[model samples]
Target chain A: MNNEKIRNLKTHAANIRKGIIEGTYAAGSGHPGGSLSCADIMAYLYFEAMNVDVANPKMLERDRFVMSKGHCAPALYAALAEKGFFPMEDLKTLRHIDSYLQGHPNMDTVPGCDMSTGSLGQGISAAVGMAMAGKLDNMQYRVYAVLGDGELEEGQVWEAAMSAAHYKLDNLLTFVDYNGLQIDGNITEVMNPEPIADKFKAFGWNVLAVNAHNFEEIDNAVTQAKQTNNKPTVIIAHSIKGKDVSFMENEASWHGSAPNKEQKEKAIAELDALLKELGV
Target chain B: MAEKIATRVAYGNALAEFGEDKNIVVLDADLSKSTKTDTFKKKYPERHFNMGIAEGNMMAVAAGMASCGKTVFASTFAMFAAGRAFEQIRNSICYPNLNVKIGATHAGITVGEDGASHQPIEDIALMRSIPNMVVISPSDAVSAFEAVKAAISHSGPVYIRLGRLDVPVIYNKESLDFKLGKGIQLTDGRDVTIIANGLMLPEAIKAQEILKEQGIEARLIDIHTIKPIDKDIIIKAAKETGAIVTAEEHNILGGLGSAVAEVVVQNSPVPIKMVGIEDKFGKSGKPAELMVRYGLTPENIVEKVMAVLAMKK
Candidate 1:
């Protein structure tokens, strides 16, 4: 990837993080830590990797994405807004009774959401299904899913892994946001889902690991996943619990709590400074 | 003796017949043989996917396939589909209103030797509670086949409850008019209404005959679609017939009985008696013996009808 492309991805990720802070702050209660953890990946997907049409969100040939770790609706809503799927001003209405941007992703109401998800361990299976459908229809569209490291404790993830490999769905790509922290605390303390890569290998998936904050590594891993034949690929994205935010970084308490006005300002200011540094 | 065929067998046959549609896909949770989705798997090997004993994954996978313009039929035992994977169906399928049909077989005590663990007496209740879910309890082979056709024609999530036991063919395929949310009236009478579904419908038919022999005219209606239930038919039955008896192979709590009473109490306020398992777990026994032991026989329906008739104003 060129320096300019890298800068563009970084700029999008920083803005997405800003949207996450703004959304959770407005909602009074939303998951920011995990949302920020996956913002870089969400930015890479909507802007760099996927073939999504902002003008026609429901285009049949468009690539599909499932936010398997769906508590991070702020990240998805932010990415969608940034990608021009909907108005950016609507981000403030996150989780409001009348807003389509729900606490979790609802594919029916939300403009660019491929599947409805919130309950952990269920979204990957939907992604596998989408990939299977693409194969059945002989469509060129690919399906992508992002799961949390803590969410790996769900047995359905393994079930989906087995089926994806069994069906030989080469079109499906998954990312595990390996921030090592869950709502309770460290994933190792709560439920050790370590040997995550080997587990995917055992379940017959092509596994890769990358620095999630680095857009070039994400791009390279995605390219390798597309080239892999007859096996679904899982890229373990090593991320921080809260990326770029000063006080919230690596903090498990920020996993589901919204920041107060002062804290929100600090988080947004840090993100703004990063954007300035990127010359965006 | 009337021709007997398990509703599961009819379900499988219907799937195979409908598998001709390129948009149709079948999914089974490693119980294809028992649930009778094997018939579809045999015909369309490419379209049928066996998710290997994971009911929850199979449901969500079916939802995913449906989202992409495929009409998917996901089959499993009732206990697993409605009990083990209730949340997946609620959130992944019903909440999104996907075009996925859940063919839940081996429902109720008629699952026989498998006992309470395998039998899902509350499957109807569980499925009925979910919004945008159409719950169908097919009475016989003909109705089960017709219900499958109706479910495919209808867009959205549908839960078709099937039985392991072979039931008497109650309706002629040529004559049966199977609509998605409509009930079928089998007999017309004024004294009492006997509304039944699934395996209990044949027993209700027998009870209707016995009631007639005893000079008591009874009405018989088959409530195949339990959710989006035919309120008009139920209210009409309650108004015309002063007394009502609801029979089903499921529990009396939230199955057809509760659905009928909900409409009756709201519309006509008729005296109603429910003939079902009395909120207890079923024991392992011969299917016929279990029916008799659980008071799910024609005699039980007859007795309930007589008692309900006494309560009539």
Candidate 2:
């Protein structure tokens, strides 16, 4: 990717981060840390990688994305908002009963969400199903899903991994946001899903790795995944728990804790600085 | 003896017949042979997916395909379909209200030799509790086959509980009138109503005959659709008959009996007796011996009917 393109994607990520902070802060509770961790990847997917239409969200041939680690729905909602799937200002209504933006990604209500997912490990299976459907119909569209590293403790993830490879779903691409920390603590301490690349490889998947924050690396991995035929690809996206915010960086406490007024202002101010630097 | 066919076999036949629809997909969790989904797999190899032994993944996968406009039928033993993969069915299939039909074979004590671990006596309860989930327990082969057709025609998640035992075919194609949520009244009487489903329908029929012999007329109803249960039929039965006896091969706590009772208590409120496994698990035994031991026989239904009739005001 070109420098200007990368810079543009960075601005989208910053805006997504700002939206995530605003959303979780307004809701008074949500997993902001994981949402922040995957903001850049979400930006790359919505703004650059996936072929989705905001106007015709249910287009037959459009690429589908499932937020498997649905706790990070703030990131997905933000990405969708930034990409003009819905109004960006509606991000503040997230997790509220009256708002369509639920705590989890409900595909029925959310304009761009391809699958309803909240319970961990099930979204990848849905993505695999979508890929299988695409193959059945001989469609050119692909299916993408994102999972949290901590979410790997679920047995269904491996089951879905096996199915993806068993069926040779090359059209399916998955990413594990390896942000290290979960709500309990560091995933290694809680439940080690380390050796994630080897595990997926063992499950007959074509495995890749990338810095999730780097749009270039993410783009390259996506290209490689598309190039690889016969086997589904999984990208181990190494990311900080909280990427841009100062105090929230690497903090497990922020996993499900909503930012207070001051914390929200500080987080937004940091993201605003990044936006200013990118001349957005 | 009348023609006997297992509901599971009927379910398999229905899938194979329905495979004529290009968009209909079948998935099995490594129990195609037992669950009888192998019949569909044999005919439409490409359309059928063997999802190994992972029922949860199969359900979620089925949901995904359904989301993409395919009518996906996911089959497995009821133990795994409703018990092991309850959460997957809840969050993935039912919550989204996808076009997925779950053919759960070998439900109840009729699973016999496999014992409690395999028999899913609580499946109907587990399924009906989830919103957007339609639960069906067919009385015989014909109804089971027709229920599959109904499930396909009706969009959203549907759970069809099938049996391992070969029960008597109560209805043939011409005589059967199968609708999604409507219960079929096979016989009408005024003394008491016998509400039954799955393998126990034949028993209820036999019990009705015995009641007639004893000079007590009884109504026989096949309560097939357990979730959006036919409240009108149950309420009408309660009002007219003034007593009810629900017979099933599952636990009395949550199966046909509880469903019928829920309707009767809310709508009409009558004296009701449930003839089921009495909240206990099944042990390794023959289907016939297990049915007798668990009080899922015609004699048991008659006795329950007599007991319920006595309670009627």
Candidate 3:
């Protein structure tokens, strides 16, 4: 929570955002809006919060992260590359036929991906499983999962939520990227998953809300989630559809579209200016 | 005749027997009693997880547990486990090639009064289509027990189909060699070959007796492992017999019959007949009555054998 740490994380977040735009632009397809929306959270977790080792990606004791909203793989891949899990140059090969970095996070092919997940709702269930595994094995590893606000509409998410509470998986921490906009427009108009925190509360989760773009609030919510006991915690991080990029920010159309050459240049220039402001 | 035991009961007993291993875990989706996983739950409460009525979540949970070095066995009725949670089984378990065994009971029309809604007549076909998925339909209680053991030892996703109706125990447990992808030849003859799995094996055996009386020496094979099927044995049988008849308590379109034909036609061409439900659903009735109505009896197997033999030049 120090100023220096906040500045470092902000720089990392901006770089991750640039990487998201670069990958999506290069691939000519991807969920960029949601990916950019979660860049800060992903940066905070991989760089400051998670206990993963860059050298040994599969270490048994390392904390696990599952991208429940797997369409936002550009954000996760950027964070993993930034954390030295793989090379930064590989981001350009995002969804190519020969590339290991698949359109969705595949654990078998990707180094830092804990589970292969493209389908919504299934990732949180797998995260609950990983948390249960840590508890059953008497290991200290914790599990973290990030879900999109629209992704909460899947019934399987609630099923997994009920199970995490039933099994008392206190070791699990779930984050909902509440960007408010989905592919079809506003989430409320598409399929109202409003009061997401209240729903998780009803399901016996320790619910916390934070400004998803703020490094301090993100850290504070994660600290509180760690302190919570006897129940799983859900940090409902309020985020914009696109966090830093100006033309794409808050636009529902950007939810799954890649930027054109000019748009990519503008987004990268904006991210570079933000990184410079952070004094990185 | 040996004592009859339901394959589900055998599955439960095998789970309990395997519970002594520290790494083995059992999960069920609120149907432990019907699926026979309650026995394992009773013995090892800590290792057992009752996933409530959510079959899809149970599969992914088993996949997660399997990923963390636990030999997980998830049980539910075949209809829910194979049909309801097909995508979960494919993506979470089979796609990852996790060490999870899906022991689904109440397979085929033998689920009886529950009718087509509960009976999973196409589970083998559904499971066989997935990559890295091993499908096994144990014929009798002894082989069902051994199938559980084999599934645990083999590393990858496996679906073990168990029946609700009691089947006459054919193999002696002491002498049973239940290896993965290995077929068990119960009787050897030259006139025709009968490939059967699950509840149809006993009927195939009975049909063999009838064929003997008619001066047709029939060969009988209990195809316990349906996927990664014993292709060598199937090709050998086709070459030696020149005719084949496949029987099962499932749809004729895609079960043991389709699987055997895929191998036989490609490798060793032979005239083949399939004795099963003729691409129709079952109605509420007694298991025996449903078997007769669906043309899944010894008589039907004999008729198919006769028809197949006639077509064999």
Candidate 4:
């Protein structure tokens, strides 16, 4: 990827982070920590990697993205808004009753969302389904999914992983946002999904571990996933619980809790500063 | 008289017939042979997906395929498909109202010898409770084939309950009108109405024969579709007949009995009796013996019809 394109993506990621903080803050009940953690990955997929149409999001040939860790919808919604799927102003309506931006990614209401997913592990299954459909129809479009590291505790993920590999879905790519924090506490303490790459490899996936925050690493992994022809790929992205914000980073308590006004302002300020640093 | 055929075989045959549609894709959770999806699989090997023993994953996969504009039919045993993968069906398929057909075989106590664990006595209840779910329990082979076609033609999530045991066909293919959400009146009477679905329809017909012999003149209605149930026929039957008896191979608590009661109690109150497994489980036995033991026989329907008729004002 070019330096200018990478800079633009970084700027977009920072803005997405801002949107996540703003949305969760406005709703007063949302998952900001995981959302912030996966903001960069969502940014890379929507902005740089996936072939999606902002004008006609329902286009059949467009690549599909399933946010398996659906509680992190704030990140996906924000990325969609930044990618011009919707207006930026709608981000504030995150979990509000009237908002189409639900607590989870609903494919019907949300323009860019390929699958409706909220419950853990099921989204990956949906991704597998989409990939299988694409293969069956002889469609050229690829499928991508984002899963939470904590979400790995669900057995359905393994089942999906097995199916994807069994079907030899090279068109499918998944990212496990290994933030090390779950709703209860540290992922290892609560339920260890470590050796995540090994598990995927065992299940016949082309596995890769990357620094989630690093745009270059994320970009390289996407390229590798596309290159691998026979099997599905899973990029186990090492990330902090909350990447940008000071007190929120690595804090398990922030996993699903919305940021209050003070926390929101601080988080947004940090993101804004990061955006400025990226020369946006 | 129609030939005797198992609903599962009929479903398989229907699926093969429906396989002409390129959009139709079939997935089985390693129960293709039993669920009858193997016919479809054989016909359209590329379109069919054997999802192994993962019902939950199979459901989500079907939902995924449906979302992508493919009409997916995911099949497995009723206990596994409806019971094991309840949440997946609720969240992935029904909630979204995707065009995924859950072809669940071996439903109710007729899944004999496998006993209670294999027999799903509450699959109908589980499916009907969910929103945007069309529940179809065809009476016989002709109806099962027609139901399969109807389900494929209609757009949305449909749960087609198929049985293991061979049931005598009730409807001739040429004359049959297997409309979704509409019940077919087989015999007319004034004493009582016998509403039945799935494998219980023949028994209900037999009960009608017995009722006629006794000068009871019981009406027999085949309620193929359970959810978005044929309310008008049920209400009309309740008003005209004054009493109703619901028969199914499932538990009395839910399934056809509860569904009919829900419609009748609100629209037109009547003396109703349910002929089914009385809040109990099935045991390891022959299909015929199990039917007798579980109170799903013609004698049971006759008894229920008589009981409801007695309570009529």
Candidate 5:
């Protein structure tokens, strides 16, 4: 992401935030906080970095992305719909019955999704497996996975982390949505995963700290990851919970609660202004 | 004739034969030597992966390989393939219904000297609980070889539970039909039906012959696929015979017996007896001795059949 692309991503980031609020508000149930936080990282990957065919989602050589932080599904769904994986009208179906835009991402129902993922801490392992498969097949494609800061408490996640480093899967890139909030409370107060970068570094991954909200920085990190031939990379992205919405920003209550009628008006107002300011 | 051949060896032989297709890839967890996949590993090292003892990763890696249209056979111990990475098998493989064959050696008490820790008594139960998972146990090396060949040709996730030690070669080397999700009935009898699978099938066959000597005609069916179990056959056996006996090299519960019983008691109620390891973990010993002690031999199947027959009367 250079200066010109970053400008486009800034607009995408704002539209994605608006999409999150409007879609969840329509369904009356969703997690907006983490979605808001992860929007920019996802935007950067989808728009500027990943070597994926937006037309043929099942392309053999296409890059793969797995959202391990599944609660932030609203953000991904918004981005996917905007990218034309499905109808933009489907955004109204988030968490609804018989909807392709499931509350959680399911690979069977969604076209662009590489794997069905909802159980936290497991998706990253799948991404590692995909990356390993890429190496085995000698495919040029890479794999990217996103994890929640709170979901790191799972033991299986670390088991996968250890194995990923052991295999020297350089084609793998993991992003942690360090939003500092969980469903119950702040992650530090619940089960802290602070000093997260050190834990991954100890496991032999090349850890890179990034401003997840900045498209340029994230794109640069991904470009750097491709050059390193023998080691896997983990980008610990620092971000605000509920990034763009004024009332929801840094609030744990927004974890799964959809905005009520009055709250929706306020949230939409904030995102609309942000989108306009970014000229989208 | 009690010629011995290990299930793991038969597995490697089966894969070696499957190598002629050029699509079958063998993946292992550093247990290629133990799982008998080293033969396949040597032939197609490009297709085989020694994921270095990482069971969960191997399973997930197998799933990825399958997603790309390759027929992958991941070999490891039964305890690890069906136990340690149960979810990986469920989510990554079975959920999407990938074509991955899990050749797990050291299943049941048959892998005796490995101790109770390594023996996978609960493996059949665990895999049977999963949807779209095929659980097969070959009674002998000949059938084990055939089962591996069948699994490679079959589409979807198949769990081939094998043993570490050499067992008897019961089936004829020339030919025996062993397709997925179907049972091979060995003999015809109206008096009782003996259903057995995996390491216990040979014992069931032996028991059927013994029953015949006593003028008792017992039906024997080798259940190679646990999921999509030959419900139609088991149902007919229950309705027509009224007495059924299930033998396995697994725990009495959640194995073939329980899976059969679940169908029998529901659609067609019958007196069914289960012959297997009854709730006790096995210890280090010779494989034959352990099989006999665990009551998984032909003698135990006969006893269980008699008990169920008594209930029918």
Candidate 6:
């Protein structure tokens, strides 16, 4: 990982961590373990990779991002707020009655949210639709989606993966957050998709395996995907269950459960220091 | 000769005609031939998308296109469009109030030999339950054409329930009487009101003639729109005519019958007799025979109207 991109990515990741802690703590409920795991990738996409205009969130040709694993909505809502799509204050209302920051992303309610998603295995299909539409419209923008390792157990995800490969959607980029744990325990123990890369290859996709938390590897993977002529790319970024917060990292208990006031304070302190080191 | 036309064919013609303006796009699940959207694919190749049997993805894709300022018409069998993709329709389309047209075919027992599995007897109930969904079931070829046009012209998510068979053409070739969410009264009578939709509209008309022979005055209402269901017309018919009989080629549970009952029972509390397929699965037969077996014939409407009249007396 290069020094500059790494610093920028780490800074964004720390904020995403801060965003998750604050949003979930305020909402009193959310999926934080998965959110923290994708903090780095989401940060990398929004800050370093995606070509989008924050000023015109509805720009027709702007790049699109779909959070296929929508249970981790806190990560996305925080990223979008940080991007100035809405007031950062709105994240405090997560899951509250009449809150635009919902438990799942609603395209109409939340600005810059490309589609409404919460139903597992359905969001990627919507992302595929977006990718297909961009191709049909002859738009130059790319479409990227993030999926959870366990959330991939749903059959529709494979159905969409097969279709994307068959159509040769080169502009589509998908990230599988290879966090071992789901809501219960280890994904391998529950429902193992061990040969996931092979599954993608069989479905005709270009596959890559990398450390998701490493910005240089993620950035390099993104660059490689862009070079491909006519195949949808899948980057299986190996990630921990709950990343960054020392005590919480790789822990399954933090999956959907929010931290207590004391635990929240300790995690926020660690994230704040991490941001300071990156000069954010 | 009343040339035959399936609702799917009428859908393709009307939508293709609307595509001329460049704002409409057709999204299909690879059943374009069965849904008669092949006619549209021929007209505007760029505007039509054959997504190859992915009905759930088709709904979300239509919603995406709708978000990008294009009005999308998604075609599939009624079972898949309404039953398979209900959540997508509810969240992406109806919840946001997007302008996406869901043109579903093969509804009711009129699907005939396809039997219960391919047929969607409960599509109306599924669609009508959504908050902002506009549900329309045109009675014949002419109304199907107009229903497609009206769906595109009007705003929001519209579910156009269609049949797989060639029904009797009831409208004059030049009649442009299609309006959004309004009841079109076909006949007026002081004794009873026969409210009908889809394949049952023709049967209701036949029942009107039969009631006349029996010296019983009957009003016939063509209730094409089931969601913003013509409340003023239904209330007036019930109050002035004394009783109402609802007839639909759908399950009596949550389709047109339930919709009309909700209105009549709340506003007027007039006696209502619902004529439709009861709580039972459908079987393979000729469309005519299946209609009788499902109790969707004109004779069934007459009987139900008489039962309602007896209750009123």
Error of 2 at B19 (Å): 1.0
Per-residue lDDT of B13-110 in model 4, one digit per residue for the tens? 99998799899999998888898888988888888888988999999999999999999999999999899999999999887789999999999887
In order, the interface RMSDs are 0.6, 0.5, 0.9, 0.7, 2.1, 1.9
Q: Rank the candidates by DockQ, best first.
A: 2, 1, 4, 3, 6, 5
Chain B only, TM-score of each candidate = 0.99, 0.98, 0.99, 0.98, 0.95, 0.97
lDDT of each: 0.94, 0.92, 0.92, 0.91, 0.84, 0.86
Tens digit per residue, CA lDDT, model 5, A1-280? 3666777888877777778988899899989999999999888878777777778989999889889877788888888877778876788888888887788887767878887667777788778778877887788988999999999987767877887888899989999989899999989999988779889989999888888897778877887887887898999899999998888999999998999889988987887787777676
lDDT of 5 by residue, B225-258 (tens): 7877889999988887889999988888788889
lDDT: which candidate is best?
1
Worst lDDT 10-window in candidate 2 chain A: A191-200
DockQ (0 to 1) for model 2: 0.91
Off by over 4 Å in 4: none
TM-scores of all predicted structures: 0.99, 0.99, 0.98, 0.99, 0.94, 0.97
Cα error, candidate 1, residue B123 (Å): 0.5
DockQ of each: 0.90, 0.91, 0.73, 0.83, 0.48, 0.50
Stronger candidate by DockQ (1 vs 6): 1
Question: DockQ: which is higher, 2 or 4?
Answer: 2
Q: What CAPRI grade goes to candidate 5?
A: acceptable
- Backbone clash count for every predicted candidate, in the order shown: 0, 0, 0, 0, 1, 0
Clashing pairs in 4: none
Q: Which rank order by lDDT, best down to worst?
A: 1, 2, 3, 4, 6, 5
DockQ of 4: 0.83
Residue B123 of model 3, lDDT score: 89
Q: Which residues of candidate 2, in runs, are more than 4 Å off?
A: none
User: How large is the C-alpha RMSD of every model relative to the true structure?
Assistant: 0.9, 0.8, 1.1, 1.1, 2.2, 1.6
Stretches > 4 Å off in candidate 3? none
Q: State what share of the real interface contacts each candidate retains.
A: 0.85, 0.84, 0.52, 0.70, 0.31, 0.30
Worst 10 residues of 6 chain A by lDDT: A126-135
